[model samples]
Target: MIEVKHLHKTFRIPAPHLSRWERIKAAVTGDGAEKTAVRDISFTVGPGEFVGYIGPNGAGKSTTIKMLTGILHPTSGEVRIDGMSPHKDRRRVVSRLGVVFGQRSQLWWDLPVRDSFDILCAMYRIDRQRQQRTLAELDGLLGLGEFADTPVRKLSLGQRMRADLAAALLHEPDILFLDEPTIGLDVIAKRNIRGLLSKVNRELGKTVLLTTHDMDDIEQLCDRVMVINHGSLAYDGTIGELRERIGLPTILRVSFEAAVSLDNATEPELGFTVAEANGCELTVHFNRQELPALEVLRRLERYGTAQDVHMEEPDFEEIIHKVY
Candidate 1:
């Protein structure tokens, strides 16, 4: 479990100098520009909850994660993990948390995958039996055996990601913080990582905080999501609640057997907004609360033989767009 309260983080950069004399003038003036990365954001993650922390670039997502993981201290406010302050007891807190940054690798580049794991186990003071068990479980879940003997530098991006995930979990931490874990991965690799995250959260009972640009990752893995923009919390709720709040209509594209003129036919009492219409096909936007999808389908059956019907759900990007 994690709790953050009124968190604010700001960085101060030296003001630009106009000339050699101006540099001295600025230094004497003590003038600097302060950039606020995270501004008074607050949230909580209950045990075993899988949360998606999402935002556009420079949205303070990574900054928040770093603060939670004790990599960077917060400027103000408090961050507590399982009732313990990460900054106060960083070493102890780290033992109970797993973190993976997609842009950085914690593994030794020249070392084989197994060697890195071995070193990590030694660093964590893990017993051989426990390390073996963890490695075996990760190997089974992530299919890491294929590249266990290969050096980290030689492994493909997907393979390295899997290995990094395994390394992060070797100690079986209670919470996992994944910062763009599936970045640069192909479709299959992304799916594999998503499945693994779901398993870890649901089956393994690990609390997961994931930040990604991929909406599929949020849809597939997160039970709850928090959207941030301009260094603030814009939206925080269940995925369903978020979709409903946006009034973002679900798109239903349907193709009828024959063209039906709207002027002559009596309008069916369907609780859906007609987004667009052309010839035999009509794009309908409906509120999930007002009309269940099954009922909509049944009503559409009355029009004509439905050739094709495709439904599109509002994605995370769309939701953020509405929030910002």
Candidate 2:
């Protein structure tokens, strides 16, 4: 299990234009330029659980990840990875972690995929037999064999990401930390990656903490989600619970074969609001808790036969916006 207690991180902001006397005066006056990237936040992850860490840009999500991975030290409080102190036992903590940063690469830029895996073998000290075995398993899961000999620089974004994931798993870490693993991929590629992650979490029984801006990732893969905003833990719970708690309207837009009957009349049957209506099309905003999708569709049928229908869930960003 991973545990964090009241963790905090602060950084000094450099001011090159400040005169030395001005800097001294500011420091003496207790106005030193500093910013807190992370405030006192605490959360825990049990074994074999998939959790999504999401927030807007510059909301201390990456900073928290770095601290949890032992890349950055917390200014205060405690971080324990599998009962080991990451600050004191970084090596031991690292051995249990498999981290993948979407914008960063751990693979050798000039080396082929196989060569990079070979290098990871030495770095993680994997025996030849185990290396081959892991490679074979990863190949089956991630389809890495086709690009095993491709140099990192020559591979496409999807290929490189698969290779990176393979490299992270070669050592058989118990916990995987993925940050925006599907940031720049097509639909098929994203689906493949999500499949791999689901298999890893369910079949392999591995613990995963994924940080991403994609709501579908949270919906499909994570049973629980933690939302961070302004360097503090704004919300932490299941995504379903979040939607229920926030009580945002799930949008249902319908295009009818004939003109819609409710052009100006307020909807009184289901206590829902017709946010927009234009002749044959009507956009509805209703609480999912009050009226489910099927019931909403049933109510819409009264107006006319729907030629086309589209349902939109309250996205993660909008939920966060509403909460904050």
Candidate 3:
């Protein structure tokens, strides 16, 4: 289990390019401002749970992950992984944790994929016998064997990601922390990674915390989601609950040979908004949380005969924007 209580992290940014005299004055007056990358946020993740931590860029997602992995210290509050403080008991906490950052690599760039795994085994002190067994299992699950002999720099992005994932699990860490692991991957690559993650979470019973801008990852693999905005916890709940809470907007675009009046459709509480009105086409947007699409379509009939009607659901990015 992972538990965080009132977590906070602050950084003091210095005023740069100041004159010496001005510097002295600024120091005395505390002119340098402090920015809190992570505010007083708190949440917990039980064993074997897959949770998605999402936010726009610079929203403290990485800050929280770093603190949890003991890569950085929290300015105040507490961080506990499986009931042990990450900062206080760094080695022990780290031994049980596996972290994957999409923009960063923990592997040696010049080394073969298998060679990197050997280095990791040495660092974690896993015996060769167990290492081989783990490799066999990972190869089966992630198909790492196909590119295991290639140098990290020579492998494709998807291949490198698979290698990195195997490297993290070579020692079989209990909890996995992934930050944008599927970034820049193609649709097929993303699906493969997502399927592997689901197996890791469900079959192996590993606690997984994934952070990504891709909402499909959350929609497919995550059972619960936590959204952070402006260094604070903006939301924490199941994905279904989040959709219901926000009432995602859906659009109905009607094409007509002639213009039709919208006054005939009167559902004041349905929160309808006119998105576009042209000479022969009309567009109406309504919240799915307020009413069903079928009902919305039926009401639109009152306007007039439409040559063609098209329904559009907002994209994943739009749903997340609503959360923010």
- Per-candidate count of clashing residue pairs (backbone under 3 Å): 0, 0, 0
Model 3 CA lDDT for position 96: 93
Instruction: Give lDDT tens digits, candidate 1, residues 82-166.
Output: 9999999988999999988888999999999999999999999999999989888888888998999999999998899989999
Which pairs of residues collide in candidate 2?
none
| Cα RMSD for candidates in order | 2.9, 3.3, 3.8
- Comparing 2 with 3 on lDDT, the higher-scoring candidate is 2
lDDT of 2 at 290: 81
Compared with the true structure, what per-residue lDDT tens digits does model 2 show for residues 1-324? 989999999987547688988777776775656899999999999999999998889999999999999999999989999899878998888889999999988999999999999999999999999999989988988899899998999998899889999888989999999999999988988988899999989988889999998878888999999988889999899988999899988988999998887743474766678888898999999998887888888877788898998999888668867866
Task: Highest lDDT: give the candidate number.
Answer: 2
In candidate 1, how many Å is residue 148 off?
1.1
Clash-forming residue pairs, model 3: none
Model 3 weakest 10-residue run by lDDT: 262-271
Candidate 3, residues 251-295: lDDT per residue as tens digits? 888887667776644557545777787877888888777777778
Off by over 4 Å in 2: 18-31, 253-258, 267-270, 291-312
TM-score of each: 0.90, 0.87, 0.84
| Candidate 2: residue 175 lDDT (0-100) | 94
Q: Give the TM-score comparing model 1 with the true structure, all chains together.
A: 0.90
Misplaced by over 4 Å in model 1 are: 18-31, 264-271, 291-309
lDDT (Cα, 0-100) at 143 in candidate 2: 93
Model 2 accuracy (lDDT, Cα): 0.89
